[model samples]
Target: MQGVDTVLNVLGSVCLLLWGVRMVRTGLTRAFGATLRRAISACARNRFTAFAGGVGLTGILQSSTATALLLASFASRGLIPLSIALAVMLGANVGTTLTAQVLSFNLGWVSPFMIAVGVIAFLSNSSDKARHLGRVAIGLGLMLLSLHLLEAAAAPLRASPAFVAVLSGLQDEYVLAVVFAAAATWFVHSSLSSVLLVMSFASSGIIEPKLGLALIIGANIGGAIAPYFDQSTTDVDARRVPLGNLITRVVIGAGLLCFLGPIHHWLAFIDPAPARLLVNFHTAFSLVAAIVFLPLNDPLAALCRRLVPSRPQADDPGRPRHLDPNVLDTPAEALACAMRETLNLGDKVADMLRQTMDALENNDARAVKAIEAADDAVDHLYEAIKLYLVQTSRNELGEEDGRRYVEILTFTTNLEHVGDIIDKNLMELATKKIKNRYSFSAEGTAELRAFHARVLENLRLALNVFTTRDITLARRLVAEKTSMREAEMHAGDSHFARLREGRPESIETSSIHMDVIRDLKRINGHLTTVAYPILEAAGELAETRLKPSDQTLMRAPAGS
Candidate 1:
């Protein structure tokens, strides 16, 4: 009965520890995700900088698994190269050990104060970033408290003869010990928690220091496994970083496991406390692995690529390329995926619009068919992005992420509207012109062509505005909406003048010409909608564009 209670308590403590680690990782990701992504990407120009970036980021994030998953997201999207990503993983491994080193110390005294402060800040602060930081502090406090509880829960087991015998058996079976720890860490999805658990057991004398060292090695190796399996994409590029990082850990961990006897003897001279010895060994092993592996990243990356060769996939522009399901838990990353997919949606619509002018001017039936067929792809991409954004919204999002989610959803919806206009309205007009072999006046053709060009440029700008959310670019995009309206009107007046001059081409194609310009203006209106959210967010948008009247009519009596 006592043993059962002990087991339950230990399990609960372990669960708390894992939850705390997750909270910290998620809070930091929510508050600083884009900045973290930009920082890592900026370092991609050089291997050393990339390595440093990984170390710093993982140190702040405190989870190599989190770092590994993030890099995998980037690699799958082709945002970061495989070799640079490998370098970052190496640094991340070292960074996580830094966390273990800090947690290994007795910091239980600070836990309550941190938790109180965190709770107060979380409840009091209105700013999203501050609230996230409070969550981080609370997570940290929970971690420290869990460590203390784990030690107490585990202390009782040290006195049990059966438990002692089981731990004693592991001292000789080093391979089993390492394998067990590796499996536990992999299952937990956190090496920090595993290492801390091992530290707690070693401090309680439930396991020999030498055995704890082997367990820590296994934990590090297992840390790499979760990310390798967590990648949602089948793209060979996306899987390379985690696989390469895993191989690196396995290689280093296997070698270290074999030399555990000598490593333990050497580390005993530094600090012989069982817990400290295991912690020191974990730190040293991570540092040594980073030093040895950093320079070999290129060759190692090549090896990973060779191991996981890219399978040829048919290029389907309609398919969602970057909506990786693995990142959906991280709203910032998931939003990025949706944004990329949305941009692809925009590209498809732009292609359709660009082809309309050529098809109408040449009376090319095949081009019109092609444009019509391409709209199906546009619809597919739009639906994919819309669904992806909906899934991302299910997660807890900060203000910034929530707004970006809406921005992405709104822009993709608008892109779909633009696609429909190009397909249903404009394509129908083209078919009519083509079937009748009608041609516009030379001047009218030039005018419509020029108008199409302007709309095309605005399409590009809208996409840029969606991506950058730059206020200046967004303002310009809105301004172009007015320009397009004026151009449509000008084209209308000019077509009427051509009819007055007795131009036969104008007389025959006047309706189609006017309809085409009207549809272009409609498309422009949809594209300009992308800029509205951006301007509104910055407080640059007016509630309505209507001017106030100088006089108002009185309301009539109800019946009258």
Candidate 2:
């Protein structure tokens, strides 16, 4: 019964530690995701900068796995080259060791104060950003407290014969010890947490220093494998990144295994305490990896590419390409996938609109036919996006993530409306114009073409606003809509004036010209709807674009 109690207590402490680590990673990610993404991307132009970027970002995020995914996402999207992404992963490995170093310190005295301050801040903060920071602090405090509990749990076990025998068995089969550590890491889904657990055990003499070192190596190698398997079905570019990073870890792990005796002896001489020795060795190995592997990024990337060659996109419309069902477990990642699909839908709408404009400008029947086909594709994509989002909506989502999901849905819906106008309304108008051999007057044609150009430009802007959620860009898009409306109205008056002059071409095409202009204007209206959701969310919108409908406001005073 006593043995069972010890096992339960140790398990509880480890679980607590893992939970604390998760809370910290998530809280930090939510608080600084945008800034970190921007910073990492900005520094991805060259190998050196990319390496530095990875180090800085992972240090702040405290999770190499998080940084790895970010690199993979960027590479998959063509935002960064594969080589630079590999370099970033190398640096990220080093950055993660910083947390292990911090955890190994004797900071039990600070845990209570951290918990108190974190709780107060978490309870007091009303703003979302502040609330996120508070959560980070709380997570940190819990982690420290968990370490304290871990120490207590292990201390009693150090005097147990059964515990000594287990250690003896593990020490005899270091390979088994490494496998056990790897399994534990995969379970926690965090290498840093796993290494810290090993460090705690080492400090209490529950595990030999050499065994602890083996476990840390296993933890690092296991961390790399987790991502590789997670991205098995992702794009070649994404999978390549984790594959490259995993190769680096495995290579280093193998080389370290050959020299483990010398390395352990060297580190032991420096640190008398088992906990400090384990953490120090982890940090040292990571530094060596960064130093040794940074120079080989390009070659490693090439190897990764060869290993996971990019294949042609599968011909499956029913399958959602960007919407990975597995990522729905993580709301932020799920939102990102949905957003990409939304942008893809926007691209289809843009294509249809482009063809519709060309069909009108050059009077091409084939372009009109193409617009119909493209619209069908757009509708199919919209259906896929809607269905995929529905599946992910069942998952638990944070407030901000839920809002982002709705924004994607709204954006995709507007794109569908735009596509409908181009295919159904404008396509029909183009067909009639071509069948009747009607041509606009010179001035009317130029005015219509210029207006069409501006509308196309605004569609591009709307898509950008959706992707960036940039309030400034969103405002510009809204403002451009007003300009587009004015242009539509002016083009109409210009057409009417040409008709009044009885120009032969204008008179022959009067109905087609007016109808085409109206259709394009309606398309503009749908595009403008994209900006309203963004502005309203920012509290920069009014109740209505007109005066209040209240009866009291309409009534004149009796004195007047």
Candidate 3:
């Protein structure tokens, strides 16, 4: 009964500790999300800066996995390179060790005091900054309290003859110790938790010093598996970093085993006490691995490239399947990638609109065939982006990303609608014109072609705005919307005036001409729809009425 109670108490403490870590991480990320992103994006120019950025971000968030995942997302988006990502991943490993070091100290008494202050601040009508700080304090306190409880639970096990014998059974065999530690850590799904448990056992003399050291090594290996599993759903390029990490650990573990006798002798010299020796060994292994690998990052990346050869025609012009699942772990980068895909969708729709319009004006069957093919391509992209966004939104995302995900979904739907409007409305109209052998007068064909060119140009500009988030392009697009509307009205009036003049060709083609103008106007309206969100994303449209400027309208003609 006592043993069961002890185990339950330890389990409860671990649960509390995990909860506290989560709270602190969430609070800190919310407080500094934008600042951190700006800092990382600005400072990560070289390998060294990227490494430092990774360490700094992970140290602040207290989660190496979170930092590495963010870097991976950046790499996928072409914002960061694979070599820089490797450096960052190495730094993240060092940053995560800070948590263990903090827990090693005797800070149990401060836990309740931190919780009290945290609660008071949370309850008070304080500023957001103060509340955020309070949350951090509370998380730290809970973590310490949990560590204290974990230590206490293992205290009695030191005297248990059965526990000591179990430890003795695995002490000398390095392979067995590695397997046991890996199994235990894997089952827990937390390297930190497994390390803490090893520390508890070592501190209480329930596990031998050598066995504890082996467990620490095994925990590192096991912890790496989590990240690797995360990469499984991502692109093949994304799998390289985690695979590198796994290979590094396996090779290092093997080296440690080969030189165990000398390693133990050196460890004894550094820390005479067994429990301290175990902790020191864990720290030393990480430090040594980092130092040895840091300088060889470029070569390591090259090796990964060679091992995982790039696919032939990977960049062929089509829908990209590179929205790796590993990227979903970082919401900002995921949102950015989604936006890129949306822009690609816009481009496809624009192509279809242009081809369909050309077919209608020229009565060309080839143009209709081209538009139909483009429509199929646009449909595929739309489905891909919708599915990707659905999967991405399920992960932990910032407020802006959450909103952007919805916006991307909306934008894709609008682009898809534009495609449908072309195929069903414009394409069908063109087919009818061809079937009837209806020929427009030269003047009418020229005017309709001019209008088609303007709408297509506007669609292209809207796509650029979406892709680049360019405020300048966005503003210009808004201004062009007015010109487009004017053009539609002028075209309508001219078509009616020609009919009133009793021109035989104009009267014969009056209905088709009116339909083409209306559809062109609608297509331009959807093109404008893509731009408003771009302005909103750039924060230029927030509570600001931006009227079209005359100078903006005179910048360029359609297709220029």
Candidate achieving the largest lDDT:
1
Off by over 4 Å in 2: 1-4, 42-49, 155-166, 312-344, 350-380, 383-407, 414-560
Candidate numbers, best TM-score first, in rank order? 1, 3, 2
> Which digits, one per residue and each the tens of the lDDT, describe model 1 over residues 204-320?
988888889889988998899888887645577878889999998889888898888899899999999998899898888878888888889889998998999988889887888
- Residue 220 lDDT in model 2? 90
Clashing pairs in 1: none
Local accuracy of candidate 2 as per-residue lDDT tens digits, 1-560: 87777888888988888777777777777667667878988888888888888888888778888788877777787888999999888888888888778878988888788778777887897765676777778778888988889888878788789888888888867677777877777767789888888888888878887888888889998888788877787789889998998898878877886777888889979987898988898888787888888888888988988999878875753345687553544567778888988888887787777777678867899998888888888888889888888877875466887888888888888888888888888888888888887777778888778877778888898888888888899888888878877887788788878878889998888888888777777777777777787789889887877865668566867775
Give the per-residue lDDT of model 3 (tens digit) for 1-560.
Answer: 88788778877977887778767876676566667667768757887887787667777877665665566566656776777778777777776776777676667789999999998887793566577778888998888788788788878877777767887788787788888887776665567667777877777667777777788889878767766677777766667777666666666777776766677789899866665676677667666767887798888888877886766655434565545544453466667777877776776777677677568767799998888777878788888888888877776555667777776787788788888889888888899899998877777888898988888888788777766767898899989988988888888888878888888888878788888888888877877776787777667775845875888677858775
Per-candidate TM vs. native?
A: 0.77, 0.69, 0.74
Where does candidate 2 clash, by residue pair? none
* Root-mean-square deviation (CA) per prediction: 5.3, 7.0, 8.5
Between prediction 1 and prediction 3, the one with superior TM-score is: 1
